[model samples]
Target: MRYKGFVIFTLFLFNIITIKPKAIDEKDSLYIDNCKRDLLVLMMAYSDEIRDIEVSEDNYIYLVLNNNKKIIYDDKKEKNKNAKILDADIQDTLEDIYPLDSINSVLEGMDPGRGRSYTFLNSIYGGNQNEIEKNLDFFSTYCGNIMFNKKAKAGEALKNALNEAKELADKDNRVNNYIFPISGSYNYRVIQDTGRLSPHAYGIAIDLNRNDSDYWKWVDKSKGSKRIEEYPKELVKVFENNGFIWGGKWEHFDILHFEYRPEIILKSKFFGDTSKSNNKKWYEGAPLNDEIENIINIINSKL
Candidate 1:
C-alpha cells in the first residue's frame, strides 16, 4: 500500500503544479486558500501518509495519495451537505457552540450545514460497505447495546465517554433521562430525504432514546419554534470531549443524534470555525495505523 501511494504521488506531483488556481472574488479566494491549507493540515494530523493536496481551478480541494486516488477536500457543491461547513455560521469553541442556553440565543450549531462526506469518511473507515462492515464491533452501555466502526477507534472512545456520562447520570437524576435505550448505529443508507450519505452509514453516529428524543421532521417545519428543554448538557459535554457532535446543537434539532466528527471539534477549538485546521497536532482519539492506511487507499482510489 505504501509503495502504491509513493508511485501515484510521484506521478501526480507534476500534474498539480500545472493546474492553475481558479479566479474568484478576492474574499472568496482567501477563504478557498485557507480551506485548502486547512484540509491538508487536518489530513496530515490524522496521518502523515497523505501524499499530496491541491486546489483546482474549480475550487475543489483534492487530497491525493500514492495510489493515484483522491478525495475532495470539501466539494462545496450545492448538493453536498457537508460542503456547507465552508460557509456555515459555526462557533469558535465547543462550549460556546453547544451552549445549552435558549435555542433562540444560539445560531452556531443551528445548521451544521456540513453533512458527512462519504468518500472522506470511507477513507477513514473503509472505501465500501463490505470493508466498513469488517470493522464493525458491538459494545454495551447503560443506554443499550450499540454497533460502531472499531477501525476509527472512536467506538472505544465513545464507550469510555459513556462510562463517564453514566457516572454523572448516576449522581444526577436529570442526566439519567438524556440517554435512554439507544436507537441505532451503522445503518448503510443515504439520508432519508436526500441522496447524501449519512454518518450512520459509516457507523460513527448514534441515536439515543427515540421516545424521549425530538426530531424537527416530527413537527411542522413552517411553524419554526422548536425548543429543547430536556437534553442533558453535561452528557453532551462528555460526548463532545470524545469527538462527537450532538444533533441537538443544530437548528434542525435531532436531540437524540450524536456523530463522531473530531475535525469539527478541533476546528472549533483552534479556528472557531471548521474552515481551517493548520498547525494543529492530532491529540484526540488513538487512530490505528491499519485503519489510517485504509483511509489513504480510499483517497487514492478516488483521486
Candidate 2:
C-alpha cells in the first residue's frame, strides 16, 4: 500500500510538471496581437504604393512604378513652349535639351524611386520580420528624418535614413541643445522648379529652432551672392551622424534645414565629421558657451 501511494504521488507530480497554461496572459496576448496588426497595416501601406514586386534573396522586394510617360510629357512640353519666331521664321531655339528619343531611352533604363526599391528589396531579402515591422513604425512615425520632396518611391530611403539618424541622436548628448520634436513629420517646400516632393510629405523630416536659423530666401538677392551661414559645427555633426545633410552646405542654403538624404551623403562621401578641417576644433578644449553651459548644468541637476 505504501509503495502504491508513493507511485501515485510521483505520477501526480509528473502530471503537474507536464501541464501547460490553459490561457495566455491577457496583457501579453494583447500586445502580441497589436504588434501583428501594426505590421499588417505597414505591409498594406507599402503594397498600395508600389507594383512589379519580386522578392530578392535578401528578402527585399524589387518593384517598379511606371513614370516613362510623365517624363516624355515633360520633355515635349518644354520643347514646344520654347519654339521661337525670329526674323519671320519659327525656329526651335532650345539648345541643350535632349531629343525625345534620348529622354525615352534614358527613362527606359531607370529604376523606380528609392522608397519602392528599398521596400521591395527588404521584403525579399528577409531580415527579422519584427525588425522590419518596427521600421514601418519608425518610418510612418517620422521618427528620424524628413521625407523626400517628391511623391516618388525614394521616400522610403529617407525613412531608413531617419531611423539611422534617431539611433545616432539617442547616443549623443549634444542632441539636447535643441528641443524640437524628433518624432513626427513636418510640412516644408522644395524648390518650385525641381518638380520634386518635399521629404516632409512622406513623414520623415525634422526642422529645428527656425528662429535661430538663416534662409537664403530671407536674404535680398540684390545683396550680390552672399551665403547664408550654417548652424554650429556641433549641431551639424549630430545631424549628419543620423544620415542627414545640412542645407548650409548648399549655395542656396537654409541654415535650419536638415533632411534625410543618406543616398546623397553616401554617394558624396561626406561622412559625419563636422569638426574644423584645421587644428582648431569647435568643442576641443574650448569652454562651453554660457547658454550651453547653463543647459548642461540644468540637465546635470535633474540627473
RMSD of each: 13.4, 25.5
TM per candidate:
0.65, 0.33
Off by over 4 Å in 1: 1-29, 48-60, 65-68, 76-110, 140-145, 220-227, 273-303
Highest-scoring model, TM-score:
1
For 167-231, candidate 1 gives per-residue lDDT tens digits of: 98889977766576667788998777877677788898888767423666775432323335445
Q: What's the CA error at residue 96 for candidate 2, in Å? A: 19
Error of 1 at 141 (Å): 4.0
Model 2, position 226, has a per-residue lDDT of 29
